[model samples]
Target: MTATEFIKKVFFFEVLQGLALTFKHMVSPAVTRQYPTEKREPVPGSRGLHALVRDTETGKEKCVGCGLCAAMCPSQCIHIYTSEGEDHKKVVDRYEIEVLRCVFCALCVEACPFGAVALSEVFEYSGYTREEFYYTKEMLLENWDKNMAGEKGRIYFEKFWRPKTVDFGAPALVKTEERKTV
Candidate 1:
């Protein structure tokens, strides 16, 4: 081999090539998320807020009150109770989630064999009361209505489809019922 080739092997062109790539990327737009204020919604199938999705068509809980989710909870945040349904099927009487303790690890949702449990896209859910945070079956269902308003809104397209701009741009104002009324 040539002495120049031997010198390059000893000096390492690979390190220089890697540094070039790093410098090239240093000027590019960043994808890092600024949490809480500038949030990114999870794509479908991402594990987030664990919930037992009801059969909207039947207006019933998808869960059969099966104990699999409870059994699988790493943090022991889940509790289940069963009752007889109108169709004589096992029904979810209570599906209590202790939010303070839940790690949001999503094991309970994965453990559910019925495809009943789903992790919602919800990323903001802070509450003042312990009672407010300790979600019941009713609360999670209600959360779908409360949080999904933006996802289903007509203005979603206008907001979402816009090209990303400067990082320091002013934050969008929150929409309220009072604002709409006026």
Candidate 2:
């Protein structure tokens, strides 16, 4: 062994360094939030539970029963049943979501053309039975009313859920080719 290695072994420099780190941490302030009494705000676009948006004018669900959300879901947790109405328009008979099976990917939100479905900020939902997690049309609408209504829902869609398309209300910046002089 070299002389430096011998000195380190005899003085236990590595052990002292480890203890110093431990002691430093012991004196440091606790970073953990008391989860029950104190809650941290969820970041924008953070996916949690699912909700169906309601049309403000009609006060009914905004879902047109297009089934795009179901088609886009990777987990296949969304289900929608639609039939012909008396006026020959499509009517949604049922809308169900297996919340337990949902992967919270938020693809359903992006696939919706009408901005009907949204992932709410509520992550505290818990239930003992599987049936409680099964959300129906009414339940989803209620979820929106409870957790994502008004300004909060609007901000969520505007900041996170809305798809960025070419016609998304922004002025296009087109570059023109310059003519070359001979």
Candidate 3:
């Protein structure tokens, strides 16, 4: 190719093209809001974190200790022990999720047959210690309440909730109290 032609393609169009596109987005409506002050709704089914749902009807832990979520977890951040319960269902003994290792893949949520687990929109969890990063059932439930607050986020979580093949689904409440032996 001629020198001028190459310059136009490389410097003028090709290299500068990316900058132009970026500039366009800068002028267009922003997709992100400033953190804390301005929060945007999470896309439905956002795999932000792992949470065992609380059964609304019973106001208790919905997790039946099925191990489906644990089986589906790719990161293996989930740790659950099971025991016999009132209905002979496997009860969760100590449901612990290592937040530092969680990938937010939504696989566990989808794997739950009873819709007892989910990926919550509460993406704000951070920690200075490994101990702090490991979330217990209580911590997960608190995140659920915080994230599920307000109508907009709640609606967004509801609509976007869809993980397939027992790998993803919708957001679930961590409100239930009946959990494992813990």
Model 3 spans with C-alpha error above 4 angstroms: 1-40, 149-182
Worst 10 residues of 1 by lDDT: 157-166
Of candidate 3, the 10-residue stretch with the lowest lDDT total is 173-182
What's the CA RMSD for each of the models? 13.7, 7.9, 10.1
Candidate 2 lDDT over residue span 1-182, tens digit each: 99999999999989999999999999999999999799998765679899999888999998889999999999999999999998899898999999999999889999988889999888999989999999999999999999999988876776555644313355333333311110
* Candidate 2 regions with alpha-carbon error over 4 angstroms: 163-182
State the displacement of the C-alpha of residue 150, model 1, in Å, after optimal TM-score superposition. Answer: 14
User: Can you write out model 1's per-residue Cα lDDT over 80-143, one digit (the tens) per residue?
Assistant: 8888878788877888888778887777755666556555667667777888778898887665
lDDT of 3 by residue, 72-148 (tens): 88989889877887877676778899889877777776676665666765667676778988889887766655555
Query: If ranked by TM-score, best first, what sequence of candidates would result?
Result: 2, 3, 1
User: Cα lDDT for residue 88, model 1?
Assistant: 86
Q: All candidates' TM-scores?
A: 0.56, 0.86, 0.61
Clashing pairs in 2: none
User: Least accurate stretch of 10 residues (summed lDDT) in model 2?
Assistant: 173-182
